[model samples]
Target: MPSVLWVSLFMWSYQKLASVYPRERPLLLLRVSGEVVEVDEKLSDLPGLVNTSPYEKGWLIKVKLSNSGELNSLMDDDKYSKFCEGNH
Candidate 1:
């Protein structure tokens, strides 16, 4: 039987949503703005893709935006990199 290892909570539009963590890694808190439309099933079986090909094969889910306005608050890749640098 399959057992859950960990669960994480994230906020979207002030609502809380629970996401399951199937691997042994740090929990990532993400601010999401949409409804999940698809999940990458291969990640459950091949967790290494998360490290080996995160930008390509390791994507976890696909979402359809619930509110396009939320895009206004997001950071671009360059800004996100700078933000992460400052935080670290």
Candidate 2:
């Protein structure tokens, strides 16, 4: 149990730190019942986020953005970081 707690703590901290980097990109959008799903690279490794946050509880997919095109329309790391920070 203590190990689990420690691992959770580490993951949370790493997520926090990772939030500072502007790399997460929304690669796919799964629409169901007029709701839009945004998928990013994080989900590629951890697909559970999709089932858990399809819209707000199950995200559908993800993509890695390298250029400043439609990606600019998406949220930046600082913005996403702040958005998540507020949730916590």
Candidate 3:
């Protein structure tokens, strides 16, 4: 069998119009659609997420981000690093 990357949301748009919409729980919202799997190292340059030069593309959602605010709550790169470091 082909080795799939095990993406949560397959070919989902980056930042969607709904992104601008107000959300209550971002993580919970993300799980609503597909399983909130591991986020990719690079962005797919898909339709939604305007594509930032992060790695390959600006991939935002591996799973569905139901609540708009959920995304907002996520920490920035620096904060995220801290979060990961603390957890590990």
Candidate 4:
């Protein structure tokens, strides 16, 4: 089974929250700032969900945005898909 890891950033400081064996290099998973209200414990048990059901059950964290205005700078689903295509 593939390894799973979870991290949290608070006030620009990085911390490792959880991990399984055979860690991989750090990757930018998401960028957001706010209180992390909840985490999906299910991910630790089902890491494959990150690839299999990303839009539904694979979400990493639930954040209550500190600045709702920050969302305006983020891409919607359509724009993000295009961005990924361009980068790839």
| Best-matching candidate per lDDT | 4
RMSD in Å for all candidates: 9.7, 15.5, 15.2, 9.3
**For residues 3-73, could you state the per-residue lDDT of candidate 3 as single tens digits?**
22222222222322343223322231321333555654333324333333332344443444445444444
Instruction: Kindly report which residue stretches of model 4 are placed more than 4 angstroms away from their true locations once superposed.
Output: 1-30
From the highest lDDT down, the ranking of the candidates is 4, 1, 3, 2
> In model 2, where do residues sit more than 4 Å from their true spots?
1-68
Considering only N, C-alpha and C atoms within 3 Å, which residue pairs clash in candidate 1?
none
> How many clashes does the backbone of model 1 have?
0
State which candidate, 1 or 2, has the greater lDDT. 1
lDDT of 4 by residue, 1-88 (tens): 1122233232112224344312432243444456766776776677666667666776666667766665555565576667668878
What TM-score quantifies how close candidate 3 is to the native fold?
Answer: 0.28
Q: Tell me the tens digit of each residue's lDDT in model 1 across 9-81.
A: 2112222324335564334444545566676778677766755775677665666666656555656556666
Q: What TM-score, computed on C-alpha atoms, does each candidate reach?
A: 0.59, 0.24, 0.28, 0.63
lDDT of 2 at 9: 13
Kindly indicate the candidate among 1 and 4 with the higher lDDT.
Answer: 4
- Runs in model 3 lying further than 4 Å from the true structure: 1-55, 58-66
* lDDT tens digits, residue span 1-88, model 2: 1211111111222232133123454332311112222324455566565445545433332323333243334453466567678888
Query: Could you tell me which 10 consecutive residues in candidate 2 have the lowest summed lDDT?
Result: 1-10
RMSD value for candidate 2? 15.5
lDDT of 1 at 61: 60
For candidate 1, report its TM-score: 0.59
